[model samples]
Target: MAEARRMPSETAPAGLRERKKEETRRLLREGAARLFAERGFEGTTVADIAACANVSVRTFFRYFDSKEALLLPDGIKVFAHVEDALAGRPADEEPLDAVCNALLAAAEPFAASTLTALGHPLEDIENVVTGRLVQAFSAFEERLTVLVRRRLPADTPDADLRAAVIAGAALSTVRAVLRTRRARRASGMTETGPAPLPRAFEILREIGSAGRP
Candidate 1:
């Protein structure tokens, strides 16, 4: 029998190749973060990241197009994962809880984001990238709002506004978690796993209920 094609684009079983690609991506991201932290942006070259990950500079480009690209959030994979997870959520689950849990399900890779792991303040990032982050997050809010709307009752009062607020609040909670990551890493501390996320949702629930009765 002929050797099965192992390319990621090939139709044959490529599980091992895909895993290797994923692992390579993770290593490059981690290497980029470490170097960016130690040397700042301009000082950290693509060659340096490749060297850190034990790959050729050519291989680095195959993964990330550029150093700046490495610093951006993993929005595409995250959005897709969140969408699928939300679809899998139980129909009877509360809207907020379903959304929260779905977001949490997509948290691991996101929470370990390279730029976030660097723990730099917003002001420290370039103005162009900072603007891009703002744009990216607005898009994130819109997507999350759509998911939130689906879980809400059809007869929800001021349905659009309510759903938007729920989505905004959920996105804010995620932002809080990422910000906490920056702060903790800056202070030489470590993350508290997903504990902060649920705790944030708990606080939001308290505030929401406080106005109810």
Candidate 2:
């Protein structure tokens, strides 16, 4: 009998392919951040970022819609994750606690790597990406309002206004902490020093309570 021909090894699993894609995207993001920092966002080109990432321009486009998207590499994912976190909170949990926890969860990645692959601090990137950051935060505020509204009693008076105020306050608290941390770092503070997230959360909780009837 003729020997049965063996088929090539099964195609790579979906999970493996996804992991590879994510890895490629991450490399491109880091590469772009470094190049943008070194050469300035306007000075850097897509081709330059692709070269730095060792990927083709096509591959870069696959991961990011445009160079500006590099400013917040995982902006959509971060906000989506925060929304999911808020949705998963215990039904009876205080609105403040839910929002604070969601924000903290979303901040984990930044806390893990406070600096870019190029060894430039995040604050430096923030300075370069302020415009993009504002746009991202505006989107964040809308989502946050929805989340806050869901946590409030349906019959509450001026629920929309209250939700907007809470969302604005919460975001402001986070931004304030970020500014303080950046200033402290600029003053030569150690990287391992106290974190500002906790303080920000504390203030958020206070704001939440104050808004309650």
Candidate 3:
């Protein structure tokens, strides 16, 4: 019997390798967050992350080229998930409601964890989160403005501008809420609180409706 020769590039093995790579990436992220929180992000190095994940420095490099990438997490995935949530909303639903639901749903992971389970101490975490939110929302506001303009009727002037203003307001509201929540926690309020995203949107909607001509 003649034996079949295998090709140089076998897809099944490649797919399995990719899956393992993804697993390593996630483990490294978790390990990095924990380490960064414990020792401070500035103090942590690639070697520390690798050691925490039980992987070699070379393997860590394969997953993330630098330490900053670990802290940022997956922006593309987060945005895509949020976009999908917005898309799922009923066509007649108010724009604010749609956006609010999407953001809150996307934030479920943070909501599920205890305040301290986020790994970083209050001040450090606030800096990291606030910096990232500012960057992300700055870009997201532009995209959302375009989306809102396109989705709404053509007769609407300044749709894009209005959308951008709403998005900025939403981001500000969320940031303020998070700051308040952190302060409340610090003051010995141990209650597991609801995410402020939805509440922020509610306020935005109220204000928008009131200000309407």
Candidate 4:
């Protein structure tokens, strides 16, 4: 019988390799963002991103399946924030109100947060990053709609679907408003106020609450 292959020993070297992989991924993502911002997403090539990150083209592929994935950055964190918000709703809160509240809270970080406030102008990066963010968010809307449906009472008629639709619409509206605000600020409109996330949630709650009675 052939001898069994010895498994690699579990040790410090293995830990170091994992850490190195994470660092490489972070570097690649940052480099790709810089290039995409500078050259436009359609104009930038994977090889260019690799060169920026100081890694081989093959290594770029290892970190990101494709250039599109590079635009998404860390999805796990976004989803986790959403989940956490949902988990924190008050027991007395209506389902739709709870969801709206959760989404409003979860989305705050992205709306006029430091990332959008201090970074390169998003309007300039629309071709590469902003456009992709919109598409990804549209998909997220569909997923959230399904999640609403799953969480609804069995006898609930349009409430589930309506909540999901409103949730998506609300998020889309908020994003559009924020984009315009960012653009205005870039053009020297220095006194932009907070994005209308809370108002959007209020609208969603109003529509959803009507179904309760």
Candidate 5:
């Protein structure tokens, strides 16, 4: 009989391999962003991005489906952070406040970076990039709904509808802030910095309170 194969120990090199893979993905993402910004999205090719990152074309495919995916990393990170924040909120916190605070916490680091990624002044971003970003945020709405539902009683009437409404309002508030901030910067009315996330949450709180009996 053939000898049984020995299983790899938990202390094997898996962690190192995973770290290297993540590093490669980061390089590809950063390289693509720089190239796309310098040469316009349509003008930049997968091969060009791979060359910029010092990786093979196959490696790029292993990391992202297309160049469009590079614009999405920050958005994906934001939603993940929001999910974690909501999961950790105090049980007694009001539902809308929980959602608002969660999103505000998640957005703090990315606020300025997000605007920079889209292009400073924001108006310079290509239509294709904007469309892709909208698609990403739409997917995030579904995730937000899941988080909001967690804050409500399991058997609450109209729980899903409530969650949906809250999620929609939260996302709409963020989008409005982005547009307003960008316009302000473009018009030379304000210096670029973190988006008014606290103010957005305050507005959300007021809206929620006003809607109640």
Candidate 6:
């Protein structure tokens, strides 16, 4: 996060320059997040992201190797592992169940928040833009849709739509879980549940009985 130049007399010109750099970096990240949301990840290019940020293409490269890089360090690799995990699921498993299990199986890489893993303290997560946070859930939902489609019969009517809905629901609990963790952190409370990722799925199961008699 950038240090704000709150008062004109409080900082030197050099400090103000540093603040400008921080602002540019932040703008670039936020721009990438918006672009990712507007266009699918693979569909968005570095130039598009740079233009969205109002920065030069070269400056975009200076900050990140690719647009997806804004989502996380080694984000490409993390997504690949998730795709591979999904591919190896049991053929007979339910699509939603398979995706949740696959994410759990590959959960180690996601054990830490992207910003925290990048060395930012928990509270300094202001740079973790909200749209960027949505990227993980969007990315996983996209992966689930593609992989779940493969698992369904070719003749399955509206297979793509079905996969997408399942994908959306598949991570609905994850969104809930992330909110819970954030609220706990903000309140200076500690988690007493089982391990965090598994605990999220436990929530999925608990709520799975939503309308049962």
Best by TM-score: 5
Candidate 4 segments whose C-alpha is farther than 4 A from its true place: 1-8, 11-13, 33-45, 65-68, 111-118, 126-130, 140-194, 206-213
Residue range 1-213, candidate 5, lDDT tens digits: 123333344435787789999999878877877876687777889999999989999989888887776765556775777788888999989788888777777654454454476464233443344445445556799889988888899898999999999888887776666666656656778554544868877877887679688
Residue-wise lDDT of candidate 1 within 1-213, one digit each (tens)? Answer: 244444444644577679899999999988877876678777788999999999999999898767777766656765887888889999999887887788777664443453467776333344324334434455688878877887888988987888888888877776676666556656778665557777878877787789675
lDDT of candidate 2 at residue 152, scale 0 to 100: 97
Q: Model 4, 92-196: lDDT tens per residue? A: 566666666776776546433423522555544533344444554555776667666656666877876676765576567656745654566568766434446
Candidate 3: lDDT of 41?
A: 71
RMSD of each: 6.9, 6.0, 4.7, 5.1, 4.7, 15.6
Candidate 3 Cα deviation (angstroms), residue 127: 6.7
Per-residue lDDT of model 3, residues 73-135, tens digit only: 456655676677778877877666666766777654543342245454545554555455445
Which segments of model 5 are wrong by more than 4 Å?
A: 1-4, 9-20, 30-45, 56-58, 71-76, 111-135, 191-195, 211-213
TM-scores of the candidates are: 0.61, 0.65, 0.67, 0.64, 0.69, 0.56
Which sections of candidate 6 miss by over 4 Å?
A: 1-71, 111-122, 125-133, 154-158, 209-213
Model 1 TM-score (2 dp):
0.61
Q: Supply candidate 3's per-residue lDDT for 209.
A: 86
lDDT of 5 at 42: 77
**Tens-digit lDDT track of model 2 for 38-141:** 88666889999999989999988898888877766456766787788788888898776777777777654543442444465545555445444445555678
* Clashes (N, CA, C under 3 Å) per candidate: 0, 0, 0, 0, 0, 0
Q: lDDT value for candidate 5?
A: 0.72
- lDDT tens readout by residue for model 6, 25-84: 888877765655556455678888788888899988877775645756454666677788
User: What range of 10 consecutive residues in model 3 has the weakest lDDT sum?
Assistant: 1-10
All candidates in order of TM-score, best leading: 5, 3, 2, 4, 1, 6
Q: What is the lDDT of residue 31 in candidate 1?
A: 87
